[model samples]
Target: MRFIRTRTAKATAATLVTVPLALGGLAAQSHAQDASPSPSGTFGPGCSALAQKANTAKDKVVEAAAAYPQLSHLVSATVRAKLSGALDGKPNVTIFAPNDQAFQQASASQLASLLSNQGQLKKVLTYHIVAKQITPDALAKGSFTTVEGGKLTTSGSGTEFKVNGKAKIVCGNIKAANATIYVIDAVLRPPS
Candidate 1:
């Protein structure tokens, strides 16, 4: 899918790259904008944390998720969506995985219907991922492209981040061979 760069994305990219050099060769400090807070505390709600222990740099997204019981539901969804291989690649990826509790909150009929439609399921599942390797600082606030060709917005800093102002990150920065995983509390729906 082609990515349509949003205005917010452009602004963020400019900020990320425009580190102006100063007399001391350090990036100039400005009072108008603030940097992201230092990383600390738990990344999310912590249904079962993988950040503290997950360091499977040789495993793909699917392989990594399969190793954690807390991520079992997400693994099943990815499998059903036929997106397991899609998440394994050279491109850096970030997945906002929703825990089992998030899935349990959904209606039975909705999930059943989604699973039956391969295309729809793929779209929904891909919306939970970003095409870039987003770090905690970058997730402070910005718009980004998803593998499903959707626009995702994030806000907050440190351990208090939210996706599209809806889903809260439960456990973040879990390393996979090809992707970074951030477990969220709610499932993110794609735009119709």
Candidate 2:
């Protein structure tokens, strides 16, 4: 009886230890799979600042962009260029919108010049847009034609990408009613 009890206790202890070890291994494996990048949904560091809301997805491109404070400069520029009507009418598009800091990066004179000339402002602004909605995967090694009729290339893996080999996409995969917006760190210029 004593021997049987000793063996039973030993077996129970071993089972307890083994079960947790096995479960822990399984938990670790599951966590690793979760850590892998997901192709769907928004990406990039700047995405953290974005307020995730269902209403944003329902709003039109111009209206959706207006909700984000960081995109105020872009919205203002688009309105000033009289592009709100045209952009709102588009069924699908990809906009590499520059943040306020990007505009500040340009010389005051350059910004003044661009903003003052409607034709030039329209050209420069249109260059930042593509006629189709682009996904993060497509952005990896892409050469797309801009709305301005200029060609721009994007390259990089995962969440990092650049436009025209210059402007880095600060935040990507943002959805609007008729557009996918990738907020870039610099303004893109069309080929003259």
Candidate 3:
């Protein structure tokens, strides 16, 4: 009788462990099923992947810039030159990048003026960034406050997204390990 009781207790413990393991696997599968498909029609290609690669936002931005040449030029030299000191050690910065055509539209003289005015340049660039990774789908037609103490109003539908009421997101959802980059057709400026 004693031996039978001990065997029953051991079997109960094993069954309890097995039940949780099966439930855990089912939960994981359910999560996978619920995950939205990537904007590019691919699976698992957003901030989740980026977060897995880099533990922090700043590190993710740096990793993305390093991987993409065009993006690197925008954040590292053109924007970084004006914002180096202020942006150093800052975390969770989301930079909206304007393509080369956007830069081409702005006269060299205008850029030069911005470079000379560090305060204005910082304000403008920082306005493009938020302290958190805001995915394309998360954005809606509303005003969002920036890290620079300015508010940007976003509008439009689906992939036709615009920021600060002017700049359009040409290519959206380029995720970095820690940051999300949206390529826009115009640079964002604060309200004057």
* CA lDDT of every candidate: 0.77, 0.87, 0.63
TM-score of 3: 0.61
Worst 10 residues of 2 by lDDT: 32-41
Of 1 and 2, the candidate ranking higher by TM-score:
2
Candidate 1 root-mean-square deviation in Å: 17.9
**Model 1: which ten-residue window has the lowest total lDDT?**
32-41
Measured by lDDT, the strongest candidate is 2
Every model's TM-score: 0.73, 0.80, 0.61
TM-score order of candidates, top first: 2, 1, 3
- Taking all chains together, the TM-score of candidate 2 against the true structure is 0.80
Candidate 2 lDDT over residue span 1-192, tens digit each: 999999999999999999999999999999864562355577777888765444567778999889888888899999999999999899889899898888889999998999999999999999998999888888778999999999989998767788889898888888888998899889888998
How big is the positional error of residue 42 in model 1, measured in Å on the Cα after superposition? 6.9
Instruction: Write the number of the candidate with greater lDDT, choosing between 1 and 3.
Output: 1
On the 0 to 100 scale, the lDDT of residue 42 in model 3 is: 21
Judged by TM-score relative to the true structure, which candidate is superior, 1 or 3?
1
